[model samples]
Target: MHGANIVLNGCSDRGRLDQRAAELRSAHGVECLGLFANLTEPGEVDECYRQIFARFKRLDVLVNNAGILQDALLGMIPTDMVDRTFRINTFAAIYNLQQASRLMTRNRSGAIVNITSIIGTNGNQGQAVYAASKAALIGLTLSSAKELASRNIRVNAVAPGFIDTDMTRNLPEGKFQERMNSIGMGRIGQPDDIANAILFLASDLSAYITGQVLGVDGGMLI
Candidate 1:
């Protein structure tokens, strides 16, 4: 893998952010810039992109990984919660892709990887809002990939299934076991599993690929 300099944008914890950046620098010998911003706001997202271009003068890859979950049954979900979930998970990616595509188009090349979810592909009972938001992202990925293909910009998505992250860890033990039972792999996926797939789509390995959604589910969708 290329040891590329990266911008850790929108990270709020300065202490932890700096600590991790130092670790990356020391371990991987890569430059890391930690910029704090609110992605749900278009202005803030724009500002973050502006800083990236101002410093690096170019953008080779864009990964839309910021998302929030507001799970509830469709009938009981509040209107505000639905709006907020879409605003952050769907609209925010659109805003960033618009800006990133602009920069990537200028260079005539770039890769964009959106972090979607398998729930987007197969609807979940209590995750109607979250699934809808992620589904929107998949649509964006396809449309953007087609629109930007002429400019040599590739747009794709990674749909992870119940990865073991801070969010998934919050599930009760019984519910977690049920989730594991649902997966054919019979084990929870780690964050690195998703990260590796993102890296593949972001790299030349998938240079010929676009408008595709790679499911990183542990055979859950199979």
Candidate 2:
């Protein structure tokens, strides 16, 4: 069971985003604080940091898991959709990393796990914008790892493929099934599968791992 004091940012008002995280913390006897910060807005992100710092005085790990998808073929993709996706998926993570890493540097030890996607590594047909944004995050993960390693901070990413969450459930059944069958495992992944990997990267077990992208995709890429 995990017994770490954790903060969940970029959570939604209805608490859906952090429901599983909170449950996991309770089951594991860990202290979990949920912050409903809209990562797309800088002001909200800063306020969320203020609250977390005010309560905990320090942060040990940061998981940038907030993201959005606007799926359309490149020609059909709206300019505004592309802009919004980049704003939330890419810019938000960068801003949070900047602020959170500053705190981690003071302490000289921390782990930052970013949630990317397989689409990022192998571009998908209708997800050009989303994939591009996630690809940028992977790049950021590597560069930040180099920049922060000297401070004893580790930066890494997890790229999940066809995870079964509300986001995927909302997709058309035929599309979802087609995607799942494409994977060698012949099934979609559960959120816990990805969450467990996140827990590992956040814990000391992965202390030696950094600047790496761990794919939790059931051999989809292979």
Candidate 3:
């Protein structure tokens, strides 16, 4: 959709990926390649990048959107929950960015977007570890931006508020209204809202923007 050949990386859902790839080809004539890899595995990450380069030969944009949320309060939080959250959300993102930056630096031009959460910006109850892991990405975004800028790679983050997704829908009914009240818009955010912000950061429209966390929360903090 953005005039760049897209390679979507996912850990599973091959059937869905194939369907979307066919849809993109049929609707927009876009060549979309979907690859599945366990992003938490360093070896898998490396192989995924190897496949990407073999096919695309170059990398331009990276959207680090893979994450998992397991909500639990401080004392009751399971150790394994923390490990899974950090592995999927923080570590895997670093692995992907590390690989993507290497390829982009060769061309001296690229954009990277990390999808964080509004809860990361303003911590919420029962999400201590989840928030912490996401906060790490903000630090990663800023630091990576400085390190990669000289190489002509831009790094940014998008913090989404309460969005209508299966993940959020699973939250307790009380949480739903609690989030709505927090947002000045008084409405739940749509996935497209986050996509638009990422697109801006990934495109030339934000050529001069980097090392920044854009909140796509419908004024949730305000």
Predicted model with the maximum TM-score: 3
True-structure RMSD for candidate 2: 2.5
Which ten residues in a row are the worst by lDDT in model 1? 9-18
Ranking of candidates on lDDT, top first: 1, 3, 2
Candidate 3 on 1-222: residue-level lDDT in tens? 356777877667888887887777677777788887899999999999999899988999999999988889889999899999999999999999999999998899999999998888889888899999999999999999999999889999999998999988987889777778988888899999889999999999999999999999888862
lDDT of 1 by residue, 2-53 (tens): 8899877655677887787778788888888787778888999899889988
lDDT score, candidate 3, position 167 = 88
* Candidates' C-alpha lDDT: 0.90, 0.87, 0.90
The global Cα lDDT (0 to 1) of model 2 is: 0.87
- Checking candidate 1 for backbone clashes, the offending pairs are none
Clashes of each: 0, 0, 0
Model 1 TM-score, all chains together: 0.95
lDDT, candidate 3, at 127:
89
Model 2 stretches astray by more than 4 angstroms: 10-30
TM-score: the better of candidates 1 and 2: 1
